[model samples]
Target: MASLAVSLGLRAADPLTNLVGIPNYAPAYLAFHFVWAYGILSSRTLKQWYKLDHQESPRYDLVKYGEAAVKSGKITKRQLNMMQRCESASANSVENYTFFLGAIGFATFSGVDRQTVNYWGLMYTAARIAYGAAYVLIEDRKVALVRGLLWWAGNAACFALLWAAGGKLNA
Candidate 1:
């Protein structure tokens, strides 16, 4: 393993590489967005889960279910609003996935160092998670500025990754 890291010009102690003990970390980092979105949308403790617990699989058409429930008076509009916010956060994650995947994928394939890739991956993930959580939990427009900041922070990581990848590719 140490030999493998040495061969790749990567340190054994780099965070994601250390976590997965692999030369490439892009795929793992990319897949985490799916994991995060799934956890947020369908996790056991989420209100949407309990509200839609009657279904065999609530995730297939969560928006439809939530809308129907609200229309039929089974759930309140406020409840629907929260569910939509959660869904929007998950959708935002999915929406951002392609760009992130491209940036990180290019970085790893272009020979960007493992430590740099892992650091940006960690930053992107943390900022995105905080952004999503804040989006779901905060209703105030004033406080919601935090979510916007986090979104920019995550985007900064992606731009940083692209810059690093471009440098490596150019060299």
Candidate 2:
């Protein structure tokens, strides 16, 4: 999507340039997807963990379990509450990120005319898949850090690409 957007934008500004090739900003878009995907996959793992810990129930009773765990001295109240809050936040983040991606995709399809932007969008999707897998399966501190850094770098690249593209459009 980002690639398409970039392509359209570039074409609008200068029609002679070929817009099908990958743009420099592709990495940045990839990073954004990486982080978002990681968040989503991790959240799923969290949900699974919650279910396993609480037994196979129709609904997650995290709040109830947390309270009970605290009352029974199995866990501190603060810890229980924090865990619940984290789970809730993770769920919300996954939904929000998915929506964001969908919006970008929609914009690209709606005649935004930027092929570079569309290409970036594809990169973002790939990065996001990797990011999610890493978040779910990797626990090593260094590995985790690298994944996070890559995700951020991708985002930074996207921002720079957007800024550069915007300049081109206006020029």
Candidate 3:
């Protein structure tokens, strides 16, 4: 949405509709979707890693519950450290995602059509949720890579759109 507003000046009725041209909408939509995908991947990865570590130690099948696992001789400090790292990664992803959302909102408010901006925002939210579910439920490397590609492509599209729009608006 922010990308759209920045690329094409905001109009009154449709936030999703490009004030400058129809093509401009594609880039904004793609950027929004990609950000969403990244969020999904982050969430899915966190859930899987959490579930895997929550139970018996990765080293052994022995059941040592919660903090006891660390207190007893079962799990090492390193394993706990790894779990903390996963949490940190999730937190970082969330921060970045919010930044992207803010960027979209800023762009939208600047000049983009309200309907087009809103539409892209909705698409992005939905895609992110699906992406997260897919990431958590599906662990195949190929699937993960493909999903990641979708996000990259979306971001690339946004950048390209912005660049094209800039020539007209910024000038």
Candidate 4:
């Protein structure tokens, strides 16, 4: 599996091994890229549905069109909620990408180990995927626990990154 290869490759590389400017976190980066792309693509479903339903003026503003669709009986409450969750997931992914960028900047400036960043980044990426899926697809109360678990995993990864980053700060 590609992930297996990436994990193996990552394990082989030492965080202490310098890569000119930063340690090679390519495996983590690759996973980040894949997850980010999926987030972007996931948002399109709502747009496509809105456009198909509103041929007269297909352009959508979530606030306006979303409410309109539900009111007009064009989409059910559940569908609208799912679409909103998907769109929110996309936005959260962008925020996560920003966090990655910020961490890399902080790590490089502080001389933090690339291995630390890479492993933590990978964890965050995987957790994000699970959290996003739970956010968008599941509506049942019984399954809320699944989402919570994913959220905790992602949150823990984020905390790990922060801790790693803290280790290298000039303070």
Candidate 5:
């Protein structure tokens, strides 16, 4: 009985699932995180490849590529700066997802209701995807609003997971 409760992410007295189940949501979120990061990093690579139109450049650094393009008058200085900003933001977004994955893992193993934890995990991932796209693709005044909303939503879901776990505590 105790083993089944822990496996189902329930406190011993909280009446968790009697059937078998593992902490699968953690891996699912991790898988999506990897795919998300891969898409962002790959897109950046493709952008660099397209800049030279399939011709291989000795330098793979995006800012260096931008600098060469700027010097050659192929792009403006401000454009080069924005390119670096987008790449930085994409990398930072991936790092943020890694932190979220840690929190999700803890929540899953700490005996929170799996369904509730999974729901919030899904929310956080979806909002993160929206936030990353808004940050990288949108460059208008409205970008802040769109990204801010998603950030708040994701944060809310993170807190909700903790709250859900707290509610299940035996105390």
Candidate 6:
């Protein structure tokens, strides 16, 4: 009975898990999945921009090809810079996606509150989207700090979820 409860994260003593609303894991998992898919598709779309410019089989390497294009006057520096921002934003999203996925999964398995997990998952998704938009749109270096704040917000949520999971598992 104890093993089954642990495996299913169904500790009868944990009041938070018995919440009336948003107490399932599926919705949180879907939120994470949507962000991951968005990152991959965004990166691919940036690559397609390069393809449009090159027309005849551009190199797959974004950094090298972008630099070469800028040096060779094939593309303007501003264009390369914009592409770099988009690519970096996509890359950041993908990187964070890995950590968020594990954090939420472990938290769920450890019997952390499903409502809390859902809130973290949804908030993290929104933060990543805002981070990407800020990264691309904010030109002023000082004002661009908003992107860093958004990134930290998402990471903080993951850390909080992981911490909660750890505490619950130890108990």
Best by TM-score: 1
Residues forming the 10-long window of minimal summed lDDT in candidate 6 = 52-61
- Report lDDT (Cα) of residue 80, candidate 4: 80
Which portions of model 6 show Cα errors greater than 4 Å? 1-16, 19-41, 50-75
Off by over 4 Å in 2: 1-113
Pick out the ten consecutive residues of candidate 2 with the lowest summed lDDT. Answer: 11-20
Colliding residue pairs in candidate 1: none
Residue 14 in candidate 5, Cα distance off native in Å: 13
Candidate 5 lDDT, 73-93, residue by residue in tens: 876766665555566556766
Over 24-84, each residue of candidate 4 has an lDDT whose tens digit, in order, gives 5745575665566464536665667665334454335556678787788877888888877
Best of the candidates, lDDT:
1
What 10-residue stretch in candidate 4 is worst by lDDT?
11-20
lDDT of 3 at 7: 53
Ranking by lDDT: 1, 6, 5, 4, 2, 3
Would you list the clashing residue pairs of candidate 4? none
Off by over 4 Å in 4: 1-23, 26-42, 50-60, 70-73, 169-171
lDDT of 2 by residue, 15-63 (tens): 3344444344434553564465455433335445544264555136564
Candidate 3 per-residue lDDT, tens place, 29-142, comes to: 546545544543333343354343433343222233434656775556555544443344345445546544554545553555544454554555554454444444444667
lDDT of 5 at 55: 37
Candidate 2, overall lDDT? 0.50
Off by over 4 Å in 3: 1-89, 153-171
lDDT of each: 0.76, 0.50, 0.46, 0.66, 0.67, 0.72
Per-residue lDDT for 48 in model 3?
51
lDDT of residue 42 for candidate 3 = 38
Worst 10 residues of 5 by lDDT: 13-22
Output the TM-score of candidate 6: 0.70
- In model 6, residue pairs whose N, Cα or C atoms come closer than 3 Å (at least 3 residues apart or on different chains), thus clashing, are none
Off by over 4 Å in 5: 1-16, 19-23, 38-43, 51-60, 71-82
